[model samples]
Target: MTKAIRSPALVVRAFNVEISRIQDQTSDPQTAAFRLQFWQDILKKIFVKEQVFQNIPANPIAQELFKVSSAYSLSKRHLEKLITSRRDLLQTKLFRNLEDIEKYADDSVSSIYYLLLSVANIANVHADHAASHLGKAQGLANILRSVHVANHHKTVFLPMDILMKNKVSQEMVLRGVNTDDMKNVAFEVASRANSHLEKARNISVPKLANQIFLPAIAVDSYLKKLQKNDFNVFDKQLQQTNALLPFSLYFKRVLNKY
Candidate 1:
């Protein structure tokens, strides 16, 4: 990575860690709210002032983020949206509809894409549009992949409407039952993710900005494997990581495709 992009990369990694801590550890709504507020205030200091890096939160993650946010002028709204979604996840499990799932994906996933683009100083409208859809695709794909793990944790990330439409129940999902209905529901969700991936592929971005979406390669590969298996979320095949993923991503990056 270029010097200009490295700090932002570090910052984003740190930011994701902070989000994971809140989402994976925090169980109390009030506590989650307070933790999110702390990060929000630190981000406010970075984006609202030019030279407040020295005065930003002392937490290592926040401190690194402040440097990148100050350097690249990352959008405060995007950063805050990232926080807000993690906070909401403390209480939100089953999405009411596909649209609700899509919105959650946009706020939680696309927000990261937008910030990375900012760090790369990409201001092109087309790239941002593509990133938005790509983020949604990746986010949904993630939920599909993690169904078993989510179920083990007693949380269902699948949209309730889709599950109902397919005659799958929360009980079936939580118990890892591989009913036809569950497979149908998984197919619908994967189809939505595939659609978004297709849309993202149709957009044109400059070579420099393409690296930001290299993750799409892995997302695409994983989705294809899931599709090939008839949308069986519990199949050990789906759980295993693709061995070819690294080479595939490298080739895609070399070709400058997201």
Candidate 2:
């Protein structure tokens, strides 16, 4: 009853886009509270108009934002907080090593999981679990895919443990080339990614995320391509999707349909 008279559907769409953009920029848990705040604010702004949102019990995200902005959902205050957070994204550390990159990756993907959970609602317990894992997996994949691009942006993606375990040096790999070192590093990362994919397959994905799973599949396909491409990390390529993927992934997901 106290909502601002906007539509929840539209709020969802706009915030979803905003969240996607942020996901592209970085995946830091430090950013979760900020992201959580963003959705909560949007929900609050529409509270006056959206009877559902207005009366909906304050979830984890809403409660946190309220501490900062008792009236934040109103006027320029809320928007300013988001803008400030967005601006901070551009200046992440110049990763001289993989350790830093992995740290950043953790933050980046965790932010995504928290934000997604805040927006999406799933009645089925299975659906809830699947979407939760899948979203985090997708975010992690995005961070991995962006390894090279993140370099250009002054960040890194792979963990040092992976680099060391595979006998790849951060310096040589970071330099990038058609060299064996880079290929080795790619193989190592891809191997790690494959593990993630196997895990993804093991868990039932939510059919509800099928529409949203475009991003998740894109991540898996990207990792698979890197594998097929002989572990080339230089090319910031999109996933070469097999047509069968959508049909199969969706069919299984329907069973867990949220």
**lDDT of all the models against the reference?**
0.83, 0.49
lDDT of 1 by residue, 1-258 (tens): 456686677788678768757756755678878888888887777766446666776788887777677667778898888888877777675688878888988998888888888888889898899998999999899889878787657788899888889888888888899988899999999999999999998999867778888889988998889989988998888888788998988787777776
Q: List the lowest-lDDT window of 10 residues for candidate 1.
A: 48-57
- Candidates in order: C-alpha RMSD to true structure: 1.6, 9.0
Q: Which regions of candidate 2 are displaced past 4 Å?
A: 1-120, 165-171, 205-209, 236-258
**Model 2 lDDT tens row, 70-182:** 33233333333344434444444334344343344334443333333333442455444544455445544655566666445444556656566666665654565447756
Model 1 segments beyond 4 Å from truth?
A: 1-3
Best by TM-score: 1
TM-score of each: 0.94, 0.52
Q: What is candidate 1's TM-score against the reference?
A: 0.94
